[model samples]
Target chain A: MQKIILNQTWKGMLMEVKRSSRTKTAVSVVVPFILLAVMIGYVFGPGSELISFGVVIPEISIEKVEFVDSEIIATVRNTGPIAVDIVMADINDRIYPAAIEPDKHLERFESAIVRIPFEWNEGEPYAVGLTIDDGTRFEKQVDVAAPSIQPTVEMITYFAIIGTYVGIIPVMIGLLWFPFISKLSRSKYKFFLALTVGLLLFLGISAAEEAIEISSENLSDVFNGVLLVATVAIVSFLALNFVGEKLKKRAGASKLAGPIAIALMIAIGIGLHNFGEGLAIGAAIVLGEAALGAFLIVGFALHNTTEGFAIAAPMARTKLMIGRLAAMGMIAGVPAIFGAWVGGFVYSPLAAVIFLAIGAGAIFQVIVTIMRWIQNEEGKLSNSSVLAGIAIGMIIMYITSILV
Target chain B: MLTGGQKMIIVITVVSLGFAGYLVFPAMDITAQEQPEVFVTHSGAVVQTTGDVLDPVYTIQEVEFDPEKYLREFDYGEVSQLEDGTTLREFTIIAEDDKIMEIAPGIFYNVWTFNGQVPGPTIRATEGDLVRIHFTNNGDKEHTIHFHGNHPAEMDGIFEIVGSNGGQFTYEFIAGPVGVHPYHCHVMPVEEHIGHGLYGVFIVDPKDARQQADEMVMMLNGFDTDFDGENNLYAANTIPYYYQHHPIQINTNELIRVYVVNMVGLDPINNFHLHGTLYKYYPTGTDMVPSEFTDMTTFSQSERGILEFEYEYTGRYMFHAHLTEFSEKGWSGVFYAKDNSQPNMEGYAYGS
Candidate 1:
C-alpha cells in the first residue's frame, strides 16, 4: 500500500512539470508581438497630436561677442521654434557672407561661434549685426577682448570622446561579421535576406518622414521636399538596375555574383544613412547636449551590430573567407568615421536632406531586389515564416529607437 | 599618517561624486530683478518705466495708450502728477462722436463718447487737490458732465449744462472722500445717457494708501445697439473682444492694481471673474485697507471697486464676467505672464 502511494505522488509531479513547460513556450511566442502591436497602434492612432507646428518664428540673437586675436567671433543662438539661416553679417555696416559652425546648416537650438575677420585695434569698440534670409536683424555693440586660443582644454576632452566612438565603433561592429556568420545556417540565412528588406523598409519610411517634417513649415516647402524624395527614389532604382545588369554579365553566374553585389549595395546605402546619423551626433555634442550624444552612441553601436549580422547573412552560403569579410566590413563602416570628421565643419540643410533622400532610395531598391529573389523561389518556403520574420525585423529597429 | 591605499580610496570617491553631480544635477535658474527706470509716460495715464528690453533699458509701450508722436489729436494732454506745492489738478472732458465702431461681426454702433472712447478718460487725483474739468460738447446734443462727488450745488455738472454742438462749460470741486466714483451725463432718464456710452470713472486715490504698481482702468458697461431699450452687448474696457484678441501681458509676480467700475445700463449687476487667482478687494477704495480676499466680486450699477493682486505662476489666465452668457458674448480677456526661472525652453511642447 505504501509503494503504490509513493508511485502516485511521483506521477502527479511529472504532470505539473509538463503543464508549466507548455506555458513557457506560449509566453515566449506571444509577448513580443503583443508589446510591439501596442506601440505601433499608438504611433498610428488618430489623436496622436503634435505639440507645436512651427507657429513661433525663429528669433535669433547674438549672446556674446569676443575678439580672438584679430578675428571677432560672435556667439549666436536661436531662441524660437523655427530654425533661421544666417544670410549676412553687417559688422559696422560692412557686409560679409554668414558663416556657421557647420558651414551652411541652420540647426535648431544649436549655437554657432562665427568668426568675423576685420581690422580692429585692441581697445576699440565695434558694432556687429547679423541678418537672416527673412530680413530679421540682430545687432549688438561689443568691446575688444584679450586674445586667446579657442577649442579650450575642456572642449578638446569632449572632441576626443566623440572622435573615438563615432569614428571607430562602426568599423568594429562591421568586423564582428566573422563571429556572427559562423552561427548562420542555410534556412536562417535566406530568411535574413528577406528580413533585411523589411528593416530597410522601416528606415526608408522613417527618413522620408524626417525629410518632410524638417522642411514642412510652408506648403511650398512640403511640396518641394516630397518632389525631391520621389525623384531620388526613381533615379537610384534605375541606376542600380543598370549596375546589376553589368555585374551579372561580367561575373558569368558565379556564386558571389548576386550575394556579393547585393551585400555591397546594402553597405553603401547604410553608410549614407550612417553619415547623416554621424552628423547628428557631432551636432548634439557641439550644441552642449552631451548626454543626448552619449545615448545616441550607445544606441548606434547596438544597431551597428545588427548591420554586421545582416551583411553576414548574405555571405554564409559562399563560405566567404575571413579576410574578404573584414574588407567588406571596412567598406561598409569606414565612411562613418569620415562622416564624423566633416560633420562639425560642413553641414548644409539641402545636403542633409539630399543624403537622407538618396539613402531611402538606395534602401528601397535593395528591398525590390530581395522581393524579386523571393518571387523566383516562390512556394519553396512558407509565406507565414517570411512574413513573421519581416515583422520581427521591423519591431527590433522600432524598439531600439524608443528605448533611447 | 594615512596609508597610500586609504588616501587613494578617499580621493577616488570624492572625485567620482563631484563628476556625477556635475553631470546629473540640474542648475537652478534665478529670475532677474526688474530695474525700474522711471520714465513717466506722456499719455492718458501717468506710467513709469516698468520693464527693460536690453542694455539701454526702455519699456515697451503698452499698445492701447501709445501717445501720438505728432499732434494729430485735437488738444490732448497726458495725465500728470501735480507739481510740488501745487494744490490743483486739471482735466478736459469732451463729449464728441468717435466715428463708428463694430461691436461684433458686421454689427456697427455710432457711439457718443467722452474723449473719443465709449467711457470718458479716467480722472485720477490725490486727496484735497482742487479739481477742475473743462467740459466741451462736440456732438449735436444737449449734454453735461455730472461727476459723482461732493461739491457745491452751483458748481455741480447737472445744474450747469452745455447745449448744442461746440458748447463749453467749466466745473470745479475740491477733491475729497478717497474712493472710486462713476461720472456720467445726468440727463433725465439716466439709462439712455449711460447706455449711449456717456460714462466714466473718477478715482480719488487716498494719500496714505499709496502702493507702487502697474495700474489699469477697467470700466464695465453695456451697449444698446438696436435702441430697443435694452443692452445688446457688454464690455470690460469699452471694446468688445478687446482683451480676447489682445491679452494684457504682465510679468509674473508683479503687483497689478485694477480699478474696476460697473456702469452697465440694462444689466442690474455683473461680476468680475478672475480665473485661477484671487485679489485683495477694496470696496469703492474708501479705506486704506481691503475688505476681502476673493477671486470673484460683483458690482451693482455705479458701484466701483479697487482690486490689488500679483500672479504667482506663469501661464495665460482668463478673466471675465462669471455669467457665462456675458463671457461668451464679449466681456473676457486673458493675462499672460512668463516665468523666467525655468532653465530650459520646456514650457512649449514641440513634439519630438
Candidate 2:
C-alpha cells in the first residue's frame, strides 16, 4: 500500500512537469514570432512608402459662413459618415475655436452651425477656414476675402532650412571632390573648365527663358525685364572685370583671383535663381494647395542637388577651404528663404521678372568670362567635348525640369 | 615622399571618405538657418518690420481629402443593359490632382489618379460586354487611358487616343481578356504615367466561367518616391499594409479566388505566397484550367493570374511573396477567415 501511494504521487509529479514544459515551449516560440512581426512592421511600415493605402476619409465642407457683429456664424457639414471632432475656424490671421465644447463633433451627413467668435476688421476681406481634429483642413473663400499671404513660423523655418538642404548638396560635393579634380593635368583641367562653362551657359539660357515666359502676357513687362537683364549683365561683367584687374595689380597672382571671382559671381547667380524657387514654393503653399507645395519643395530639392555641381565645378582648379564653401553655400542658398517669404506674402509679377532677369543676367556674365578664359586656353580643351558637355547639360536640366 | 602604391591607397581612402560624407550629409541636415521676425507688406514684400501686412502661409486653410483614412474596395456603377439587350459597362475615369494617399504608416504619395484612387476603380464585366471608358484629364498634364487586353485598334488608348489638360477622351471596346488586364496612360513615357498612379485592373469573366465564390482583385504594384527609375515601395491593390491591417474577411468553407496582377515598372519581378495552404494557380488569365497547384506564385512585369483556394480552419491566414525579403517589405498581408471574430478595425471606413 505504501509503494502504491508513492508510485501514484510520482506519476502526478511527472505529469505536472510535462504540462509546465509544454507551456514554456509554446511561450518561447510564440513570443519571438509576434515580436518579429511587429519589428518588421515598424521597419518596413513608414520610410519610403512607394504606394499609399486607400482608407475611407471624412469629407467636410463649409456650407455657410458670415460675420455677425464681433462673432462669425458658420455652418459646417460632414458630407461623409465619419464624425469630426475639434473643428477650428480661421478668420484673417487669428484662429477661433468653432464650438463651445471641448471638441466639436459632426456625425455622418450631419450639419453643425458652429458659432465661432472670429476677430475681423471692418471692410477687410477676411480669409476663413474650418479644420477637423484629424489634420484635415479646409478654407472657405469669400468673394470679398483677401488671399492669405502671411506665413506661419513653421513655414518660415521650412523655407530657411530647405534651401540649405536643396542647394548645398551639389556645391558641397563639387567642393569636396575638388582635391581629386585638381590632381588632373592642365589639359584635363581645361576640359573640366569647358564642361563647367557649358553648364553655366545652359543655366543662363534657362533663366532667360523663365524670365521671358513669366512676362509673356505683357510685352511691356517682357521688354522691361529683358532690358534690365541686359543692363545688369553688362554691369556685372564690367564691375567684375574692373575688380579682377585691381586685384591683379595688388595680389600679384591672377590665376587664383579669376577662379575666386568666378565662384563668387556664380554664387550670386544661383542665389537669385534659388530666390525664384523659394518664391514659387511660397506661392504654392499660400494658394492652399499644400500637396502641390510639398511636391514643389521636393522637386526643387532634387534640382538643387544637381545645381550644387554647377556652382563648384568651376572651382575645381582652385583648392578651397570648408569655411569658404560654407560661406558660398550661405550666399547661394540663403536667398531662397527670403524669396519664399516674399513670394508667399506678395504676388508681384514684376518682382518675379526682376529676380529671374537678375539671375539670367548674372549667369550670362559668368558664361562670357569663362568662355573668354577657355578661348585663351585655345586647343588645350577639346571643343567637341565642350559641345558634348553643353548638350548633356541641356538634356539633363530639361529632364530634371520635366521630372518636377 | 610616398611610394606609388601607398599614394594610390591614400587616394582611394580620400575618395571613399568623400563618398561616405556625401551620403551622411543629407541625414545630418545641418539645421536650417535662423529666421528673423519680419512683417509682410500688402503689396507682397517682406520687410524686417512689425505689424505691416496681411498674413499668409500661416492661415490654417482647409485641405481637400484626408489620405490617412483606410482604403476600401470602391464600386463605380453596376452592369446594366439597353433596350437592345446589349450589356454596357461605362466607366468614368477622371485624371485629377491633389489626391494624396498614405502608402505606408506615414509615407504619403501624391498621385494623379483616375477618379481619385490609386489603381483607380476596378472594372468588372463579362467576356462580351460593351465597355465604355470615358477619360478626362482634370489635372495639369496630358493623359490617356490605354488598356492591356484584347481590343480593337480604334479603341486602343494609345497612338491618337490622347487628352490634354482639362480635356476628355472616350475609348469603347468589347470586354475580352485572355485573365486580369491592366489599363494605364500610354503617353510617350509609360513609366512616368504609371508611376503617378494612373493604372487599374480590368476583369473580364470567361464565357464558361469557373465556380465563382468570393473574389478579390489584387494589383501588385510599386511606388518610386525618388524618380531614380526604381521602386522604393511595393504593395497590392495600391495600398501598403492593406490586407495586414484590414484583412479581407471570408467564410471558412467558402472558396476564395484572387486575381493577382504584378504591375511593377522598375523592378524585374514580383510574387505571391499563401500561408497554411496551397491553391490552384493559373498564370496568365487566358488559361481554362490552372497549370499548377502551389502555395507560391512568381511573376515578372505585367504577368497576372487567378489563384483559387479555401480555408477549413478558423484562423488568420497570411499571404505574401515567397521572396521573404519582398514579403515583409510591404508585399505581405493577413486573410481573416469567415470565422474570424475579432477584426482589427483601425483605419476602417465607416460609410461607402
lDDT string, candidate 1, A133-216, tens digits:
443556767544434324556644554456446544654565566455557764565567667766777777876666565435
Task: Write down the TM-score of every candidate.
Answer: 0.40, 0.38
Candidate 2 versus the native: TM-score?
Answer: 0.38
Clashes of each: 0, 27
The digit string of per-residue lDDT tens for model 1 on B286-336 reads 887899999999988888898988888887688899976566445776676
lDDT of 1 at A310: 61
Per-residue alpha-carbon lDDT of candidate 2 for residues A1-404, written as tens digits (9 for 90 to 100): 99999999888887879988788888999999999988878765778364455776667655445555445555555656456653345454233333322125555544455554444554466556654554355656554422354457876777667655555554455456567656777656665666666666666777767767765632232135466556545554555455445554665666776666667767777787788777777766665557877887877776665556666666666666667766776777778878887767553444665667667767776676667666766743457766666666667767877888
DockQ of each model against the real complex? 0.02, 0.01
Candidate 1 fraction of reference contacts recovered: 0.00
lDDT (0 to 1) per candidate: 0.63, 0.64
Against the true structure, candidate 1 reaches a TM-score of 0.40
Q: Is the docking of candidate 2 incorrect, acceptable, medium or high quality?
A: incorrect
- What C-alpha lDDT does candidate 2 achieve relative to the native structure? 0.64
Candidate 2 regions exceeding 4 Å error are: A1-404, B1-84, B338-352
Worst lDDT 10-window in candidate 2 chain B: B49-58
